[model samples]
Target: MKRTLSVLIACMIGAAVSAADLGDDGLHKTPWMRDTFKDLREDLEEASGEGKRLVLFIEQRGCIYCKKMHEEVFPQPDMAAFIEENFFVVQLDLHGSTTATDFDGEENEQRALMRKWGILFTPTLVFLPEEVPEAASAIDAAVAVMPGAFSKGTTLDLFTWVDQKRYELDNGEDFQRYHARRIQERNNISQE
Candidate 1:
């Protein structure tokens, strides 16, 4: 009984340490990221006189990779600075009940929106474009619904491509090629 109790305590301590290592303190920190994201939403609304495009990053509270990203990626000087300057960044907890207002005047809790939008994994990024009645079809087709973790360079390239409206120019081209090209361009620019 004594030996069993000692082993259990050791396991518990190990698990606790691992959990601490994977928590939020390890994730990316763009202090202005949240504000930028909210502003992006407002800017989109102003630009199109409806709602412009904005990006939403959805992450779970206790995810380790989420922490790794918050700590390892966002805080990188280039990423943090670029994100602050160019993007509207908001963090949504996948399991929380925080209220969110859609442009269509619909009110849904965070978790519900996650489900409605078919989000099945953590660290999903969804881009929503300004909504206009006549352009609903265009918005539906052009706005990207992406999910999963993305490295800083890849993430930056995606937004840059979106801003250039490259999607419209690549009617039938493969997505992989488009993304690869964007990545290459970013790499080349960084090298220079």
Candidate 2:
């Protein structure tokens, strides 16, 4: 009985260490995530002023995929540093009652805003461009939207692609192509 109890305690401690810290809202909290008044227009302005792109991270409580991202992909030094350097991240609760101002100057609850953006996933990442046209909603102005959790390589590639404005380039390397190329490069490097 004592051995079983010790084993249980050890497993609990290991799980705790592997998981990211949770906020009062029950969402995973990262050091790079900013706490704002949920005003997206102001958030965008602040991000741009800091030479970083505005990224909206939509998550909810009890999401295993969100937990996987926070634990496996986001905590890596390269991934974390890259995100910190290039993106001003804002966390939005999918079911929270907190008020959030949209880029179109419309104010609504965070959940309502998520509905407006057509978000149906726990870990949707909305990447916004630097300049938003007047009267455009956040969804309409987004350069890219990652709708679910991705592996570290894919996440890094997406972030780098958005940061480099590869979507605007006429080279015909879309995200699919870009990600495939990166995978091939990684494979080749691993075999060397």
Candidate 3:
């Protein structure tokens, strides 16, 4: 009985530690996340002014994938540092009532905007270019949209590729090819 009780206590402690990282909104609280008025155009301008790429991170409460990313992937030193230095992150709740103004100047509740964007998953990362065309929505102007949780390498590669504006390059190496190359490089390094 004592052993079982001790084990239960340990599990509770671990859960508490993990939950502490989350904010009252149940979103993972990261220093890099911007507290904006949910205006995409202004966010884009602010990111460009800071010489950083604009990234919209869509998440929902009680999403295990979001928890995994917050605990395992994003907190890694390299990933954290890379995001902090290169991207301006704006987080949006998947089911929240907060008003969000899209790049095209259409305003709606957060959930409605998510529906309009056709986001069906938590942790959908929308990476935007520095310059967006007039009358283009956030979804329309996005350079890359990463859906669901990804491994460390994939996440990092995506961030790097978008930041470097690889999408603009005429190089035939698209994201799939680029990811494959990176995986191969890592395998070779590990083998060596």
Best by lDDT: 2
Question: Could you give candidate 3's per-residue lDDT for residues 41-62 as a string of tens digits?
Answer: 9998999999999999999999
Off by over 4 Å in 1: 1-29, 35-43, 46-53, 130-142, 171-175, 183-192
Q: Residue 50 of model 3: what lDDT?
A: 94
lDDT winner between 2 and 3, please give it. Answer: 2
Off by over 4 Å in 2: 1-19
lDDT of 1 by residue, 48-137 (tens): 542224567778866666776665655555554444445555666677575764444445776776676667887776665544343232
- What candidate 3 gets wrong by more than 4 Å, as runs, is 1-20
Q: Predict model 3's lDDT versus the native.
A: 0.86
Task: Residues 31-105, candidate 2: write the lDDT tens digits.
Answer: 789999988899999999999999999999999999999999887666676777789999999998999999899
Q: How far is each candidate from the true structure, as Cα RMSD in Å?
A: 14.0, 9.2, 9.6
The better-scoring model by TM-score among 2 and 3 is: 2
